[model samples]
Structure formats: structure tokens, C-alpha cells
Target: MPPEHNAGAEHMLVSMLRPLVERGHDVQVWLSRYGKAHRAYEYRGIQVVPLQARLDFGTAARRADVLLSHLECVPSTAALARGYGKPLVVVCHNTHRPSLRDVAAGQTALAVYNSLWMEREAELFFAEYPKAIRPAESLIVRPPVFAGEYATRPGKAVTLINCNREKGGRVLEQLARRMPDAQFLAVKGAYGEQILPALPNVEIVEHVDGAEMRERVYARTRVLLMPSSYESWGRAGVEALASGIPVVAHPTPGLTESLADGGIFVDRNDIDGYEAVLRRLLGSAAEYRLVSKRAKARSAELDPAAELAAWCDAIEQL
Candidate 1:
């Protein structure tokens, strides 16, 4: 998931798809709907072409057997796939109305939901548009994480991976101020303007690759914080769990579902509540160990071997 300039959702998608290359599949990812101009390049074996490139996406997509897309591009991708008379595999990452409405249009041959809650949300959307048809097949295929790759000895720093406003950058800033002596790590995300507050205790780390996260980020992290306003699925939290690092996050549907028993849930707005939880984990060694043990246990439950195999089968079946 080469994360230098990537967000969680795209990173997760790439990680889940990387194994297909090893299995001897010809995988080419096309960025068709971006307004910005960027050069095409290869990540690992996958060739990624941006919308601005001389070779148009429509020409490339025409030659390809199937089309894969998510987010804001779903509606247009559906149209393209329908027009081309090709199968569409739409990855449902969120409950955005237009995207779901587009999925209900019946052009999508396969609907890959990131979580069960998302799958249920899709059902509700189906009810909302009763006349709209459904995809032929739909399944939950969570973003896969290789536990061993992410596992590392947890450190003492309280950390938040992305310091964007919606991801609760201000919440992190307030927490740092509340606890002057406590060390905090704020990692800048690949996208968005990061809120870099002037605080002595809070250390900011520039974005790094997902391969470098274990050593560069998580190695110094004891507690992972995600105070996102919304999260489709908390991949960072799950990655933290792999290393026996306790995650303290806002009770977003994704965090609650993905973290399960591994996370320490705290409302981002409840500053007092967030402070107390942090103090307990940071102060009490026994409490930290207990939570760390739970984190490791949760990570074991989500072994990526089976999930990745299932994902590959679905992709091949498409």
C-alpha cells in the first residue's frame, strides 16, 4: 500500500489487490475522474495512470475486461461500464447517496462492501430506491492487513496517524494541550491541510510509506488515536491491533466494528473522557498490558490469509 501520498481507503484497496499480481494477474489501475494533472507510474507491478495522461481512460478501459472503482467516480464508472457493455466491480467504501444510488442502477456486476454495516446501509439504500435494481452479487471484503508486516514492539507515545480536520486534528491539539508532560505524535496524512499546532510535547512526523509505518510510526506508538468525524472502516486501528498497540477512537461505525474488543472507545468531543482514558493507558502498566493483550487477540482473529484468499476468488470470479 505504498503510503507516501495515499489515504486510508485507497491504501486499503491497493493492499487488498496487491496479492493478485503475485497470482499472475494483469492488473492496471486507471484514475479516470480526477480534475488534477499527474503523470502515470507503476507501484510494485500495478501500473497506475492518472486522468490527465495522453492515453485516455476510455480507450484503456475499453481494452480491459472489467472496470473497478469507488467513491465519487462510481456513478460515471457505472455509465462507462454500461456503455461499454463490460462487467463493473464497484467497491462500496461509504454510504454516500449518489454512489449507492449509482450502485442500485444495476450496471455493477459485483458490489464489494467494506463492512457488514456498510452492506446493511446498502440494503436501506435499496429500500429508499425501491424501483432501482441491485447488483448481481454483493459481499463484504474488508481491507486486508498482513498482521506480521504491521506487528512491532509498541512504544510509549500517544499517536494519531492523520492530522486532518475531519480526522479530528483539533481534537488531538486540545488533548496535547491538556496533558503538557505527555508525549504525543501527530503524523501528517497524504492528503488535506494538516493542522500543525505549536505545542512542545506534540511531535509531527511527515507521511511515510505503509511499509515504513511499523518502524517509523507504530514503533513509537503505544496508543493509536482516531477521532474521525466519520470512518467507513478504521484500517489504522486494525494495523495498531496487529502490534498489540491499543487504539482509542471515537465510536464511529467503522472503528466500533473493525476494532471490536481491541479499541478503547472515547467520544472525540468528551475531552475529559479522552484525557482519563489516555492517563490510564499511559500511567498504569498493568492496564496497558491488559489492553495490549486484548489488541493482539483481536488481531489474531482477523488473520488476512483467509480474507485475502476470499477477495482474490471474488476478483477472479468477476
Candidate 2:
């Protein structure tokens, strides 16, 4: 699966829905897979439930005006929408089948692409396969990373949020070894096998929930190191920019589009390049300040106000 479908998708999904709730719309999230226990949880005014929760899906689907979902759950969620004749909004976080499967099948009434690249990928996919069902309408809403909630006084450690191989965990390890004197923070991701290095200068942090990310991680990060081999859109990188935190990242199309001029591009495999960039930031206050200013400016351009308003308006119109 793509890194975009990782926890970032969930965060982006919630960010999109939160606005609906604010605008007096009823919003609920049903967890597709969970332990056998019937349960429900809540976050930022959103009520989340397991499939067998007290408020069962059949009832929810039958009554729901519209269904919004993504990735692994899209298939079953799309089914509920079709069964109830409700509109389906599939948020595309990846170019892969799971994210676009329902969209391709024309099961989705409104398809929300998380990045321009992903939007194009879906377009190309449908164009290549003439028989596929196209979505009636489409829109691009990059993962909303609101600065107010995410911003904090930046701290010192060079941080990498997810330490999985595809997320450039190995690249982080190599960088850590090369720059022994520099401090590095390795954050264990909510999913995937973590490949953390046992280096003295590297402090390993346990996996954290989306709610805890602002305080527990970003507050302590000065630079976000995203060496991911594949990122549909690096939400974490944008989150860091909220606080004027510079990001050194691998040149993925998604990251390139989302971060824009905010990101310092580096080859993930080029440990030396990563080291040079990190060293320059550490050694030159002027360069760091310029990059930091650029990061903040970029974050402002991505303000969720207009994009979120459009998202809410579209969903509400349905």
C-alpha cells in the first residue's frame, strides 16, 4: 500500500469531516476492521464505531444522506451507499486499486483526489481502460493541514515520523550513522515494521495517535526528514511546515506538489546529500532562518479555509 493510505489518510479524512460537523451536518465514522468487540470512540467531535457497534451499519447506511470513505474500506462502504441509494464520496489517497477501486467501478458519486498527481493518475487509469466506470464528479483537495492546530514553537531534533522501510527508515538509519554528533528522533509509525537504529544520538519514540502528534512529536522537531520512496502526499511534511520547520525529503511527485518550494529535495538513497543539508541547517543560522521563513510561507498558502469550504460545500450539496 502507498504511504498516503497510512495514518495520514485517516487524519486527512477527519480534517475533511470536521468542517461538515461545524456546519451543522451529522458525521460518523465506522471502522471497517477491529477486534470482535462492539465498540465506539470519538475524536474532535466525530463519533467513530466498529462494524458491530451498538449503532449498526445497516441502520446508519439506511439513514445516512451520504457515505464518505477511502482505501481498504471503500469496497464495503460503497456497497452500503449503493444498497441505500445514498451518494458515495471516495477520498482517493493513492493511485493503487484499493483507493481507486470503487471510483473506477463508478460506485463513487463524488471522487475526492488528495493530490493533483493522484487526480491525474485516476484520470489516466480510466482513460487507459475505456471500459471502467468514471465518477460523475471529481475534485482535488490536498490533505488539509491547518496551521493553528499543528503549529508550535519548533524544537531541535531532526525528526522522521514513520520509521518503516518504505518511509525511508533505512535512509534515516544511514543518515544517523553518518552524522554521529547530530541528534535524531525516530518516531514509530502506527503501521508497518519499524527499522530503528540503536544509535546513541538517535532517540526512538513510540507510535503516537494523530491527536498526540502536535504536542508529542512536532513540538520537538526542527526539521522533518521524509525519505519515503513513495508518498502520494506527505501530510507530515506539511504539518512540520506549520511551525516553520524545514523538511528534507525524497523527490516524490506527491511531496513535490504538496510541499512546493517549502521542501529541500534530496535523494533518499543519498545519505551524504541528506547529511550535507542537515549540517548546513545546523551550521548556518541565516540559511536555517531563510528556509524556516519559506516553510511558514508555504504553510500559509495551504490554509484549509478555502479548500475546506469547497469540500464542505460539495458534501453538503449532496
Which candidate tops TM-score? 2
lDDT of 1 by residue, 146-260 (tens): 8999899998799988898989899889999999999999998977789977899999898877778899999999899899989989888999999999999999998899999
Off by over 4 Å in 2: 1-6, 35-38
Cα-lDDT of candidate 1: 0.85
Ten contiguous residues minimizing lDDT sum, candidate 1: 1-10
Error of 2 at 24 (Å): 1.2
Off by over 4 Å in 1: 1-4, 33-39
Model 1 misses residue 164 by how many Å?
2.0
Error of 1 at 226 (Å): 1.1
When superposed on Cα atoms, how far off is each prediction in RMSD? 1.9, 2.6
lDDT of 2 by residue, 179-293 (tens): 8888899998877899899999899998777767789899998789999999999999999999999999999999999899999999888888999999999889999999999
TM-score of each: 0.94, 0.95
